[model samples]
Target chain A: MEKAEILGPAGNLSSLKAAVDAGADVVYLGFNDSTNARNFEGLNFTEDDLREGIEYLRGKGKKFYLAINTFPQASNFKDWENSVDKAVTLGADALILANTGVLKYASEKYPTTRLHLSVQASASNYEAINFYKKHFNIKRVILPRVLTTGEIRTISENTDVELEAFILGGLCINIEGRCYLSSYVTGASTNTEGACSPSRFVDFSPTDGGGMTISLNKITLNRLSAGEKSPYPTCCKGRYLTSDGELSYAMEEPESLNALSLIPDLIEAGVSALKIEGRQRTKSYVGTVTGILREAVDSYYVNPASFAVKKEWTEKTRETFEGTSSTLGSYAGK
Target chain B: MRDKMELTLGPILFEWERSEVLDFYKAALTLPVDTVYIGEVVCVKKRSLTIKDIETIGKDLEQAGKKVVLSTLAIVSNEEELELVRELSKLGFSIEANDASALKIAKDAGRTIFAGPHIKTYNKHDAFFLESIGVKNICLPVELPKESIKDIAQNTNLKYEVFAFGKIPLAFSWRCYTERTYGLSKSECAWHCKDHPEGIDLRADTKENGKKAAPIFTINGTSILSGKNLSLLEFTEDLRDTKVDALRISPQYKDTGEVIKIFRDKINGKINYKDSSERLQALIKKPLTNGYYNDKAGMEFLEINDILNV
Candidate 1:
């Protein structure tokens, strides 16, 4: 039985320690710049902070992957290039990228840098995966959440690159990086800026019916009763009344993707790494999930028969911070 | 600047029948549009029409004195889609690259392509970059303001295409909103999009479903479409003055030719802007909105505050 590495997020220093303590073999993080996708305030690390973070992780004998995932616009390409150069200068283990042009430039300019395809690239199948591998020397590809375990198996068989799949995290209602819904509703860019259904454009108004009305730039997203949970005000996940007079969640409800049950199957499908979703999460979230998954991965590899969807796994995961109540997403695969 | 603007009929984005699609092009031949993009750009599963369908439509449109372009899907998720895009690029007809992967493949194939509106080409730099990659015409993203369009049009050498009439595609996604709405997965979605020919409109959500409380414009499979059918008839004169080479009219559920004729009359200076707008708005099956072109947010009507400088 092959043991896949458990990757965790470290939004800040405390989160980094938590992830390490919780048993993450490798931790991924972003720098506080436009280069990384999660370009949020008070999130990500500075150069000195990254250096310190690297040292801290090194002391724990863990690996660190620096994410520089945003596709650079024509003017911003230089900024991204500089960040990649800095990441390399800092002895980062790997670079996660989505932009074809950037991948090409990096592969040609710095051949030694390990490149992992970001989920934003939406390379779901073998041919798309092969294209990235052939052109930019991508060593691994992050499978989008939309794929099934069957799709994952087919994709893994077709590609030589290591496959990483999301086992836990927030569900992106849009197709990975292919969504323009966020940018269209709000001027902010989700692909490059790393903010989805950006917070700036969303607002909550008290509906006449006592529930809250979630609004994205003044378009009423949904009207939830005051007692009903008001989801994160994303443009897509809200309920809609279609032209057919049907009222339903037209896109997806605010839910977290929890695939702990699929652990043995994911290993069977030849996934090299199991990644957790939230990067803007707290230290507690990073530590708890990382520790739990780390143990699960170990137990499964050590004795497949003894490994089960333990009740404790479910309870511990539920205790961790999630966008919604945990869910086993659509990977019973096509 | 040319006094007469060219009208480009953008590709039929939905899954229309092969016969209906053929009939659509034959009708488009007699319409006021100078160019037509014909292909299956939306769902890969909706294969009611094939390459043969595209070839027949292209030949008929070309014979009818219209330039024909083949369009690619906006969100290419897998190998099948990439292969489809590559095949589309190889077609002798002009191509409209909607997503980045298509643009890359088209560029690599050395084909002169039309950069579709969904490309999100925001500034002069992005425009210039597209032009460098052999993009002859660039459709402005729907969310762009009039001023931004004007600036981009004036600065870029490539021809600019704006949405003139019909439901502007606000967004495209991997998860089919239609399937999700119907409680079916994307693979099992039963072509329910045909049910709402004008696309679905998410009304004001008065009932908030926790975390799910947001204005939803569910179309097919996680795809949230725009609430209002985009009406730029009032802005035709402004568009004309901005050196816009073409105005794109997307084919909707009904009265598409009539909408084109109304735009033609406005563009030819045969009708007043307000009357043309009113006529077009009345003809549309859905409510008219100029949200994207206006500087205001996508949903609300633009309001002028009295406190602004006179």
Candidate 2:
């Protein structure tokens, strides 16, 4: 069995250091703004922070991947293009990008820098994966969660590019990045705007009756009992009234994916790297997930048959899980 | 100058027999519409017709005094679909850019384009941004209220198009719910979607604590259309006053020409809005709805007189 790279998300300088110390073979970070997917306030790296972080990782003999993955608006190609140039100039190992325009530009300007396709592009099958490869010379693709393990194996067999799979963090009910359900209800789009279920659109109000109602853009998403905790009110997870007479999760519930148990299976299926999501998380999260995945990857290498993952491996990953809920996600082929 | 407003028949979205599609477009030439956007805009795996068939239809529509534009698939899942978009662009005809990637290619080719509603142009800022990117026209998302559309239209420089009739396309994706229903993988879907041309209707049970609520229509992986088709034939006056440049009527499995004629009479002022609306409703084989236009919950409907007061 070949070794699989353990990747971690770095929201800031502290998280970057923690991820490195915790055994991250490669750490991924992004600049603040739409150039990266997690375009939140007070998170992500500054230019100096990126520079310092890269030097630290290089000294430790580790790799750094820059996420310049957001889609580029027709007139806004400059911001996306400049980030790619900066990533190349800063000696970053690779770029994880979603936009075709950005990919085309980077292939022309930085032909040597490895290009990994972001999950935002939603390329599920071999044909879609190969399309990106032929056009932009993408080296690796982060497979969308929609695929089953069998499908992933088949795709890897057909495509020339390496494969990366998400092992932990937020699980999107709709196809990641391709989802418009949030934007349809809240006016903030995840695709171009880098914000889905934007915080401003969410409001939690106590009902006159004992519970609290979590609303997104004035539409009630879900309600909780007096003592119950209200989940984040994203449109996909919202409780709604439909035409056929029902009140339920019209889309899905808020849950994080914990795929530690499937690490060996993914490696067996020819996965090149393991990605841990949630760049908006704390250093504790980055450290914890990176540590566990690192051990699992190393164990799989030492003795392939001895690499049985205990429930505790994924349980350790659960501490960094979002929304206080976890699922095996699509990795088990469901 | 043309005296009549351009009526564009949206491309076929379902898998119909190739002969049926050819016959439909051939019959569409006699209608008073101005333009016809031909070709498939749904699943890429449907290999019923080739690009040559679309070109022949475009020629026939053009010879019938109607301009023709080819539409690419809405979801560009893989390389084959990307090649379809590239081929459509190389055809040297007007194209409707559905996805952002399509818009990028259309802009690269410097082709004048109609931006599909799926592109998400919400406010005046977005409209202006798209206009700057060379989108000559835009179809507001079906879920947007008429007031927002009117407000944005009043401020933006780009032409606005409204969904006048047909089953609204609420969403699209790489997963084929229709195939998944039969316990089959999307790759080996067997083109099962060819069986349901309108869409296979589904019901969701949203009961919590033993209370019954309205069940919403859940269709394919891509679309969650309203139980009722969007009928705006009766509101042509209101739509026109919003300064909308055109009204887009999506093609269904049947009676497309009659739907186009009813809207034509209303837009031409040949009949009153009420009379035109009643006749249009009577012509439809199914229930009609204008919920999204009224800006209420997507499934709710309002009286025409009440809509006027609002």
Which candidate number would show the highest lDDT if scored against the true structure? Answer: 1
Compose the digit string of candidate 1's lDDT tens values, residues B1-310. Answer: 4757888888777666657766777788899989998765677777667787677778888998999888888766566777888887777888888776777677778777898876756556568767766789988777667777877788778889887666557655656666656777777778876665556567655544553333334364345566556677776767778888888998875788998999899888899866776686577634466655665545444422221221
Question: In order, what DockQ does each candidate have?
Answer: 0.32, 0.14
lDDT of each: 0.74, 0.73
List, residue by residue over A19-94, the lDDT tens digit for candidate 1. 8888998889988877777777788898888888889999999999988887555346677778788888888889
What lDDT tens digits, residue by residue, belong to model 2 across residues B77-124? 455666787777776678887765577666667677887765555456
Candidate 1 at residue B184, lDDT? Answer: 73
iRMSD computed for candidate 2: 6.9
Q: How does model 2 score on DockQ?
A: 0.14
Candidate 2 lDDT, A1-334, residue by residue in tens: 3478889899999999999999999999998777888877788988998888888888899999999887654446588888998888888889998866677779878888899999887676676677578777999999887666766787788888999998887767556655655655555657656767778878888887788878766656677768765345666566555443345555444577777777778887778899988788899988888888888888778888777876777677655554357777656643
TM-scores of all candidate predictions against the true structure: 0.84, 0.70
Off by over 4 Å in 2: A208-210, A227-231, A322-325, A331-334, B1-7, B11-170, B173-248, B251-259, B262-310
